[model samples]
Target: MAGTRRIVVIGAGGAGLAAALEAGRAGADVLLLEAAEQVGGATARAGGVVYASDTPVQKARGVQDSVDELINYYMTVSRHELEPRLLRASAEGTRQVIGWLEDLGITWNPDRLYIAGLEHKPRGHMPTGDTRGLGPAGGAMIVAALLTAVERADNVEIRTGTRCTSLLTGEDQVVVGVRTETGEEIPADAVILATGGFGAGTEMLRKYWPDAVRHGDWHWYLGPDTNIGDGVRMGLAAGGELRGRGGTLLETPNFGRLNDAFTPPWLIYVNKHGHRFVDETDTYCVMPHLIGRQPEGRCWAVFDDAALQKVADGGYVDPYGLGVDLESNWTAAMLRRQIEAGVVTSGATLAELAARTGIAAAGLEATAEQWNADVAGGRDTVFEKQGTLAPVSTAPFYAVELRPAIIGITFAGLRIDHEARVLDTAGRPIPGLFAGGEVVGGLDADVYAGGGTSIGNALVFGRTAARTATGGAA
Candidate 1:
């Protein structure tokens, strides 16, 4: 034990667990630390979709994809803000990472689908299982598989409920170990930080990513509450450089929480001014930006009892087929509960509905009348929304006020290179220090590309960090 290489990995999420397993398999003395009682962090709550191009699965499905195309698409998505080396590494390593997960006994869903937010061709590989409320299922399934593999690794030891408070560095600025919250100093030969983002820390969010906080209210994060920037603090204290400091993946539905990327086409979304904006059925990524540009980053879904009844009957049409299936996604019972809680307000008339929801009565009445006319004409003349249309008629109209929510990935943390080595202010890697997962940013530097991008980044770079730290091929 004394002579063996000791590699300590902080956080037990997708990236940390993957790194620990890789290092353990490579015969390194690996120790995984987690602050929470559970092993899965935000990854457990994710949609479990991983993006990989030119995989064997693609060949089987008759889909032609190339790493070159992937790199081109990714560069466009990042707006050329990504490091060329890391971007290429991520794109090229995707198939390998997916194969690695398969070797670990994780089964991918048979359907190879194209996700909308990617702004590219279909390459998302979803794990097989039930998805989150509205979209790609089986994040928990992936977590379970990785956890099983980690448990079977002979050299890997996982210690949960142990929070890493700081990084232990030598006088030469090389990370040597981590300090636990309980005042225990565990020395190691190398350290990997994968402790996720600061979505839950209002103070940290205000200090580092203040733009997300609008009028003192940060948007809700759907990730694990445990993600509070512990790794960012430890890495920064050890002279790690921060990258993509102000980027985030936010999902704010104008209506109910289907948890999927589904926005009902039957309803009209209006800003505080009671005016419709955006093509309602646009991708979640596009919808949120349009909503965030509003006065208070808030919007409302206005519909009537007729549309509500159609929704309750599970017969409403989703033109783009982007969201969850109507029959299986949500229930009228859920809406009734929200209505009882006053989060979903209703009234008999547009004027009364505006009064209850604090919208301008004149604007609300006019928008509703015009929308009804547009529906009757089978055209969304204002937004050019090409799909089936419905009017907000009938008594007992309703309004569901919505704010932004984030769960996919937080994009503000320590910067790392293609090999997953954490860097300092001078752009040199801190010796023996590496990072991956959501803890290391720059992939989703500004706008998010798709659902699986974060998970792909975590798995691909987690293995990279582990292999390099263990003196194996990176």
Candidate 2:
């Protein structure tokens, strides 16, 4: 609490980068430590969409969205579990975050498009142009921009391949700094943990929540292998309490489609009952919640020649025309392998497929018949599934088995106060220890909005934490 404050930020992901940049801008001597060789945890691999209400991007597009409406939408989706103060801060500060990014030379596209399920007005901001040339995920552009800003700022040191093993506590029980794997202790006046969540930590997932283990079959997309809940463990050891229970998990189709990358635009998803459970085009945030309600927390993608053709026409298929056919992708040999491993089942007829997959043959046939009929009638009766421009009546139906893949960025972590300080068991802020991003939970308890909840909250809280830690206006 003295002259030229020193700060240590653990993790080089989006939240960590944002926090470090803000603190450095505030004139704090900052050290950014990353466990992996590269920066950007899940953020680098994300779709690069930031949900910011009343942003200049939205204004440029003439979209009508306000902080009050954003708060209302969050409350409606969060089901009142999210703290009102935190929601207000996130809503109000999002504009500033966007502005700061723009000032840092990150360009945003002013396109207003609405995903069907979310209740908010169109206010999603995406990065301009195609970022595919940068990397597998468009997050490369975001991380590159932030890192560029960090480099230009004074008094900021970014050290890669340095792991923060533990927190350094002083006699007064305040976190002083962190001890790295090299047995070096970096000193600081304040410490921030932004190491993301427990997606790739299968062992931790089993230890904490054993029920989640059943869906372990679908952990094919291992995001940021280093994000093993180290931050969560460190915070808990420092006496921080975790919040947000009963969160959801999701299962996407096998990465076999998008050149073995985790691209979307799935053809169809079927449960263990061999029945289509959710609308494939639903928001990604809500899809996990829907998947949790199904049996075994698992599902499969069923598509055929016509549906694949439709995918090709809609540009959902590979744009480069990689010559990687889905038939080749979902071959009989591959299906046999999956079936032998108990991951998938196949058949020539719908009834046969249903029998092999252990689904009620009559029910599956009726579902398919009704679905085809709905396609013919241009209306879905049960799920009211929009975007039914293709039908699933082709022969030799293909089913690729899937289980819920828990991406890193847990909806549960340390509880924090309005100032972004970690809350104690008795609900008091722990001095000198601040947290944001997925490290601080309760933002997505019962409801999830799609546009930009994760990135928006990360930027908002990162800035707020910097302001609070440095005694600046938040």
Candidate 3:
């Protein structure tokens, strides 16, 4: 008895679920394997935004945009370090995926559409769905929709609590299936590796991303503990090559690992010498990078008693409420707790504060004077920070050392083409092999594109890989 095309999609995250649903809908038998007790991977913890352009969502919001414009912004922000062809694929695929996801019970509110990147356009399409307390709101909403669709699809079989240890190869160096840790081998006509980034893997971080290790013991990953570079390791053993570098690092005061990427704008950031280095309210995509370039590869956040009082008065939380909640580390309540515990350094004067925090006293005094002057004059002279400028002249000055140590997305992974087919060292696509999500590399450059670009890449390449492996039916 001949069966339908059997495809195995590994790692049941957004990318894996997308691949499984697409392949099953396209008439292929799909075996979706997940190592964790649950699906969703890191996508489940994201803010649930998909970056796109020139879609009905944008049109409904009365924002006119084009694929060309979107790619140009992406290239410009990445300093032209990305592959134009790959960016084109991502731009086009994400725009269409918005509609595809809509058909699967997800909703996009025109009012929720906002600018998510450094770009000057509104390309961040936020999906409206219920995570049912599963994970992060927006991303969990997306993963839930895809998971429901996959569950309803008759041809897709989901296997949880199963960890794939290696790849099964046949003659001609073609991948056939995956070998589980239990020595179980399930053969398939094709395999798509969707296991996510290596941010949580210690050895992988040491070898591939030392920038993360530079923070030493303070470094920690936000993704699930299961994202240990499984897909990349299996792909490498199967003759696939690696590409790309760097990852997303969010600045944190080590506030109990709550995934706080955005900070309140009421505080100003200064380097080791007590010099303002960047706009205090700059986007997180570039905030860590800017801080990394400072002396000692770190910075301190300075605030006056007034701002701390504002926090206590229930203000200064992340205005955007990034990643599904209004709470942040910048809350005055949290600050007071740390302050009482001596984690936050305080001084009665600028010179005293600088001395306590090891900052140059003269530089700190001069910078505070300039900041106060700029705020009074209603203009930021140096960085032109656009946030509400509160004078730092209030008594009991404070400084808290902040480091970009919370690892979010690891960018280095398996090399894949625009169609999501895994490529070997010689730049040839391996037969019956594909990948998606953070598992595929070369999509990011020196700086992260934006907030939603990661989840966008996951869904786009997941569907792309399934469609390619299923002969374009997906």
Candidate 4:
């Protein structure tokens, strides 16, 4: 006990669990703290994909990819706004973390590898098999596996329902311990902040990203409510600086607050000017950005009575094959019900539809005419939409307003170096203070790079922070 290093990890999410496990395995005493009663944070409610390259899974699947290539794609998507050193660490660490997680009973089926980003190569590695009744499979499965491993580590102790209020710094402003809301102080050799993003914090949203709350009542968060910028507040008080901005905002119809991510492929999304903005089948990562660039940042799902009538009742359009069927208001019965309730706007013609939905009439008419021609010709020349092309020709047209208001992940927080050490305003590492996950930013730009990058960064930096905090090599 006298010679061993004691590390206190706040927020028992993916990053915190990985840090606790890594430190505990390295013969360091770890105290994993969680504000919520449960252990998992946003990681548990995610899609559970880990984006990595040059891994055995990709190799086994006959996909030759490299970390350099992945970094290049990331930088290109982020417009070179991300730190190269941290990106290199993330790309490299996540590659090895695949094997590490596999060693901990998480299986990566080479067959499940898919393209999760803009890259042509497949780098998104999804876990195979059931989650053993641990909530929904993806992120829940990953969380359950990490939690089980952490529980088995003898040097690791978990304390939930404990909220850290502030940091205790000794001479030279080095973090010595954390003070809980109840006035209890837990001293440690190093403190790891992994409280995730601040999507649920309205004040932080107004201060950091006002656009996140532009729609007010229509805007919603898809993460845990505890992600309210506590880590950012404490880190700022501890002389830490913030980095990065914006986050992933999925397009939502706000129909009964359903958790569905994708809509039926047959529906076309048009901007307020009645112009199709992007491919109807693009990933959720950049859909919001594309929509945000439109006039007034308003989007609508346009369809005809024919397509609505042909809608099946069983399952909505899920091209991703992620098995995420929480709720769907797209069924024919539901559509008719919403249309009857005036929730789904309808009109007898394109002009009437545009007038009712506030879309430009000429643009809507042109788009419908081109769409009908594309459908008849069996090709979509405009957006090259890969989904089923349903002609917008019927007695009545329908339009369901869509908004990119569902906040998924925030990208701004404390600044950290490549080794996962929190940095001050002068870019110097804060001694005895490490941070990971969404709490540490500068890893992304305005647009999200990939789907699994968040979870991947959590595991990569979490382990790296533990290794560095324990005075060991990563």
TM-score of each: 0.88, 0.87, 0.96, 0.96
List the global CA lDDT of all models.
Answer: 0.77, 0.70, 0.88, 0.87
Candidate 3 clash pair list: 48-138, 48-139
lDDT of 1 by residue, 1-474 (tens): 656899999988889989999999888999999998888887877767788888887777778889888888878877788888898899887789888888867766546465546454678787664332322335666677788889998889999999989888888988889899899999999998889888777777778877666633326666777888999888888888888866544444323433545566777888878899878877655566678788777688888888766666443333223343333222466566667778789998988999988888898888988899998988888987766577988988988876655434568899899999999989999998999898987877567776677888888888899999999888
Query: Between prediction 2 and prediction 4, which has the larger lDDT?
Result: 4
Candidate number of the best lDDT? 3
lDDT of 3 by residue, 138-205 (tens): 88899999998888888889999999999999999999999999999999999999999998899999
CA displacement after TM-score superposition, residue 190 of candidate 1 (Å): 0.8
Pairs clashing within candidate 1: 131-137, 134-260
Query: Which ten contiguous residues of candidate 1 have the minimum total lDDT?
Result: 320-329
Off by over 4 Å in 4: 129-134, 315-320
Residue pairs with colliding backbones in model 4 are: none
- Give a tens-digit lDDT track for model 2, residues 312-431: 332233311222222333333544555567565556887877777666677677767777787788876766766544566886665665555545346678888777888888898777
Q: How close is candidate 2 to the true structure, as a TM-score?
A: 0.87
Candidate 3 structure, TM-score to reference? 0.96
